[model samples]
Target: MKKRYLASALVLFSIGSLFVGVSAISPLEVFDLTEDQLHILTASRFPRLISILLAGASISVCGLIMQQLTRNKFVSPTTAGTMDSARLGVLVSLMIFTSASPLQKMSIAFIFALLGTFVFMKILDRIKFKDVIFVPLVGLMFGNIISSITTFFAYKNDLIQNMSAWMQGDFSLIVSGRYELMYISIPVMILAYIFANKFTIAGMGEDFSTSLGLNYRTVVNLGLIIVAFVASSVLLTVGMIPFLGLIIPNIVSIYQGDHLKKNLPHTALLGALFVLVCDIIGRVVIYPYELPISLTVGVIGSGIFAYLLIRRKAYEV
Candidate 1:
C-alpha cells in the first residue's frame, strides 16, 4: 500500500505490457529495432498501455469519489446504471445518428450516463430502507433494467452484434488512431484532485458541509458528472471493465484511510497497477491469445468483492 511500492509495481508492469503481445517486440531487440517494430511500438502497444492506465486510474478515482459522496463502500459506476445507460446511449447514436463520429457517440453516451447517475442519486435519497449492501443491489438491478432495454432494442434493430462489442472490456482493438478520446479522463481526474477536500466535506453529510460553508449538493453533482464522463469515455473507448472502480478504491481506503485528498494518488497508482497486472495475465494466460479484460476482472474482482462483504459483515458483528 506504500506509494513507492505501488509506483514501482506500476512501472514494472507498464514496461512488461509494452513487450507482451504476439508481435514479437522483445525488450532485447529494442536497441536494434526494425521499421515494422517501431511502427508496432508507436501504433499499437503504447496506445493500449496508455488507454489501460488512463481507464484504470480514472475509473478507480471515479469510484472513490462516489463512495465518498454516497457513503457506500459498495457503490460504483458498474453497480449504478452508469455503464449500462452509456451503452444504451451508444446504441442510440448508432441508430439515430448513423453517420455520427466516435466523439459524437461519446457525447450522447455521456449525457445518458449523467442522467442515469442522477436518477440513481434521486432514488438513493428517497429510499427509506438503507442497507450498505442492499443499496448497491438496487443499483445493480436498475442497471440490469437499462441493459435489458438496450438489449431489446439491439435485437430489434439487429444491432446486437454492434452493441455487444461494448459490453465486454477488450484492449485488443485499441491503437493510436482509435483511443484518443480516453484522454478526456486526464483533465477530469485533475478536477477530482482539485475538489478532493470538498468531496471529503460533502461525504460528511449535507448539514455538516453546509455548516462548513460548502454547497453540498453542488459538490455531489460535480462528483457524479466526473463519474459519468469518465465511465462513458472509457466505455466508448475500451468497453466495460467491471469492478475496477469498486475494488481498487476500497483496497486503497483500507490501507490509506478514508481521506479523499490523501488517498487519491495511491488509488490512481494502485488502479493502474491492478489493471496492468490483470491485462498482462489476460495476455499471457493462454499464451499468444488473450482473455477479455471484463472476464479477468469480473472473475477476480467478484471474488474480492465477496470477501470484502463477508469481512465487513464480520467486523460489524
Candidate 2:
C-alpha cells in the first residue's frame, strides 16, 4: 500500500507539473524555454499552481484534524457549517466594510468561521444521535440554513453579483498579488503537525484524552481554530473549493490508518494531486474557456460522498 501511494504521488506530481502550462509550452519545447515562456511559468502559472497545491493540501489536512478532534469521519467545513458561516462573514464585510482592506475581510471571515465551527461542536454535544453519519447530515442542514441567510442578504443588498463571483473557485484569476493570502495555510499546517499527537488522543474520545492528562477541550478548540483560519484564507483567496476537504482525508485513511500524524503527509500529497488533476480537467473540458475548481471538485466529490453513504450500513458513535 505504501509503495502504491508513493507511485501514485509521483504520477500525480508529474502530471500536475506537465499540464500546468501546456497551452503555452509545447511538449517538445518543455525542455528548451524562451524568456516569455520563463516569465509565464514564473509569474503566472507557478504562483497559481503553488496556491492550488497548498490550498488543496492544507484544506485536506484540516478536514483530517476536524474529523479526529470530533471523532467523526463525515464532519468537514462544508458539512459542519464552517464554509457557509465564512461566506456570511464575507458578505457582511462587503456590506459593512465596503472599503475594507483584504486583511480586514480575512479577519472577519476567520471569526465567523471559528464561531460557526464552535456552534456545530456544541450542537454535536447536544444531539444524541446513535449513528455518526447522521451528525454530518444535521450539520449540512444547519449549513444550508446559514447559506440561505447569506443568500437572502446578498440578494436584498445588491451584493449577490459580487457574492456569486466569489462563490465559485477559479485558478484563472490567480496572479501574483492575488494568491499570497493562501500562504497562510503554511503556518496552520505546521501547527497541525505540531499538535498531531494530541489530536490522535483526542479522537479516542473526550474521556480517554482527559484521563491521559490532556486538556481535550483546549486541543479541540485549537484544532478548530486551525480549520477556521485555513477555510477563511482559502475562501478569501480563491473562493470556496468544495469537497476537497471532505474527500481527500477519507481517501487517504483507507490506505494509511486513522493516525493523524502518520497520515498527514500522505493526505497533503493526495489532496494536492486531486486538485491538480481536477483543475487540469476543468481547463481542458471547456477548451479556451475554463470550469471552476468548485464545480469540478463538487461533481467528483458528490459521487464519492454517495458511495461512502451507501457503503456504510451503520456508524460507530
Candidate 3:
C-alpha cells in the first residue's frame, strides 16, 4: 500500500539523515556514540529532521486546505500571497521591533499572512474567468507585488541581508531550542484533520454549505487562520519552502481522490517523505556544502507543476 511505502521510506531516510551530516558519525556507531556524537545527534541532527518533517507536512496541508476552500486545485499558500505577506511581516518585525522575541515576530507574520490570504479569496470571488491556471497566475502576480514591497523596504532599511536569510528554506542551522516553534503546527494539523469534512463541504460553495447548516464564512475564516499560522511559523522557523504545499496535496488527490479527510494522512506522509528525500539529496549533491531545501523542492515541484498543468489541459480536451 502507499501508506506502507511512505511510512517505510520516511523511517529509512530519517535514519539515514541522522548519519548524513559533515560530522564523521556512522549508523553503526549510533549505539556507541561518544559524548560529541550523542550531542550532535540530540542537538543538531534530530532537530533538523523534525523541522524538515514538520515544515513539509504542515505546508502541504495548508495547501490542501486552501485548494479546498477556493475550489481551485492550483491555489496554495505559495500562490496566494500568504508566504510573501508573512515575509513582509518578518521585515516589519525586524525594522520596528528590534528587540521583539521570535514568537512576537511570528505573531505579526501570522496576521499579515491571514490578511493576504483573505484578500486573495476576495480577489478570487471577483474574478469572472476563474480558469484553473489563471487563478494561480493572478495570485503569483499579487504575491510578487507584496514581495516587491517587502524587498523595497528591506533595501531602504539596509536589512536585505537579514531578509535574504528567510528567502530560502534551510535546516543547517536547526538546533533543539531553535526548532521548538515548529511543534505548534501539530495541534493545528490535528484541528485540520478534525475539520476535514467541513472543508470539503465548504468547497461546494457558500449557499450549499449554508443549506447544510455550516456557517461558511466561519469555516473559511478558520481555514485561512490555520493556513496563515502554518505559513508564518514555517517561514520564520525554516524560511520559504516553495511548492511543498501546492504539489503534495495535488499528488495525493491524483491517486487517492479529492476528499480532504481521506487525503490528509497521505498528503502528510508523502510530503514528509518527499522533503526528507530532497534534504538527503541536497546534502550529498555536493558534499561539505548543502543546497537550500527551497532550491531542490522548487526545481522538483516546478517540474511536477508543469506536468499537472499539461495533464489538466489534456483532460479538458
* Model 2, CA-based lDDT: 0.86
TM-score of each: 0.99, 0.93, 0.99
Q: List the residue pairs that clash in candidate 3.
A: none
* lDDT per residue as tens, model 3, 241-280: 9988888988999999889999998999999999999999
Which residue segments of model 3 deviate by more than 4 Å? none
Better of 2 and 3 by TM-score: 3
> What's model 2's TM-score?
0.93
Question: Could you tell me the lDDT of residue 195 within candidate 3?
Answer: 96
lDDT of 2 at 283: 82
Q: How does each model score on lDDT?
A: 0.94, 0.86, 0.94
